[model samples]
Target chain A: MDWVSHAQAELRGAGYRPGAAARLVLEHLDREDCCRGAQEIFDALSTGGTKVGLASVYRMLERLDERGLVQRIDLGDGIVRYEAARDAGHHHHLVCGACGKVEPFADRRLERAIEAVEERSGYSVVAHDVVLRGACANCRD
Target chain B: MDWVSHAQAELRGAGYRPGAAARLVLEHLDREDCCRGAQEIFDALSTGGTKVGLASVYRMLERLDERGLVQRIDLGDGIVRYEAARDAGHHHHLVCGACGKVEPFADRRLERAIEAVEERSGYSVVAHDVVLRGACANCRD
Candidate 1:
């Protein structure tokens, strides 16, 4: 099952009602490869004619985060961003410092290195985030 | 010369006066192997009988960051942390979720993978941060 369905099922099984706002947040996050901040999500949903409040978005994200249904990412800025959590197709972020653009990229070699670190350090790593910052191709020109 | 001396020289070259506060902040950060937040740095300095204000610490950190003298790190938490930037002895963080302990570990394999990504992605990756979260040995037991 996809992450949204799995998350819905998990929420329902945990006796929490999956309301429209919750579904909207999940669906919005599901469509994103890069993470979005709470305010950004709220603004997007509002622009899309949804009436979800910013507080509601934060609450829903907090709930999803508690259940490991979403990954919380900090782009070295003050804002906290959220993306759907997945076991496969894992990726990291490339942030352009000049234009504030974010892109997702995946690499198996990096994953192997992380595994090696876990084995060597004896820390049972449950989550990890990699953020690379620089001038993108567009900004570099 | 060490990172502190190099940073001090760079600041001087940039036409900025390296005040007593800046020197104290540099010395404190130089002694730490891990990153620390501005407030934490201020508190530590105050506890050690220094009278530098928190705003001065922030201003100093901003100046150093502009000169690439320090690295800014966000450990998936709300706080922004800083550490002295170095040419060698590069490392990433392994944070224990349960106890909130952050430990730095270095892996050349990871660096190679990042270099490979930069080559393939066409991004001029100038800086990067990796943060891994999990249970520490004591917390797991």
Candidate 2:
């Protein structure tokens, strides 16, 4: 099943009713390719003429987080962002410090290093995040 | 020079007067192997009988951050943490989801992967952070 459908099912199975607010939040997050702050999500939903409260969005995100359906990200700018959790096609973020843009990238060598760390450290690593901060080509000039 | 001294020199070169509070904060941060929040730094200073206020600690941290003498980290928790920036002996964090314990680990393979990404993406990658979340050995029972 698709991520949204899978998440909706998980939410329902976990006793969540998956209301209109939740559905909107899920669809919005699904459409995003990068992590987005709660305010960003609310603003997008508002701009799209969705009548969802910011608080409801946050609550839905919290629920999604608790159910492991969303991954919370902090890019060191004091803003909490969330993205849809996935079992495959995992990626990391490259944040432009100058323009505050986020792009997603994946590297297999990094994955191998993480596996090595897990084996050596004897920790059951369930999740990992790599954030690269730099000036993008556009900003470098 | 050590990281603390180098930081102090950088601060002065940047027209910042390294006061007693700044010195204390730098020393405290220099001694910690893991990132610490301002409140934690204040508490540590207070416990050590230092009279530095939390606000002073925060101000000092801000100055250090502005000078690029410290690295700010947000580990998907709401708290923002700071560590002394190092030019060498770089490392990342492994955080325990169960106990909230954070341990530092380094892998040269990860560094290689980062270099590869920077070259391929043409990003002037100034800094990066890797955070692994999992159950630590003690918590894995």
Q: Report lDDT (CA) for all predictions.
A: 0.89, 0.88
Interface RMSD of 2: 0.9
Best by TM-score: 1
User: Candidate 2 on B32-124: residue-level lDDT in tens?
Assistant: 988999999999999999899888988988888777788877788778799998878578889999999998888888889888888887788
Candidate 2 segments exceeding 4 Å error: none
Candidate 2: docking tier: high
Model 2 reproduced share of reference interface contacts: 0.91
How well docked is model 2, in DockQ terms? Answer: 0.85
| lDDT by residue (tens digit), candidate 2, A11-123 | 88988898899899999999998899899999999999999999999898999988888988778887888999896857888899999988888888888988888889888
**Comparing only chain A of model 2 with the true chain A, what is the TM-score?**
0.91
**Could you give the interface RMSD of each candidate, to one decimal?**
0.8, 0.9
Write model 1 residue lDDT over A1-80, tens digit each, in one string.
Answer: 88888999999998899899988999999998779999999999999998897888999899899899988888877789
- For candidate 1, the per-residue lDDT at B99 reads 92
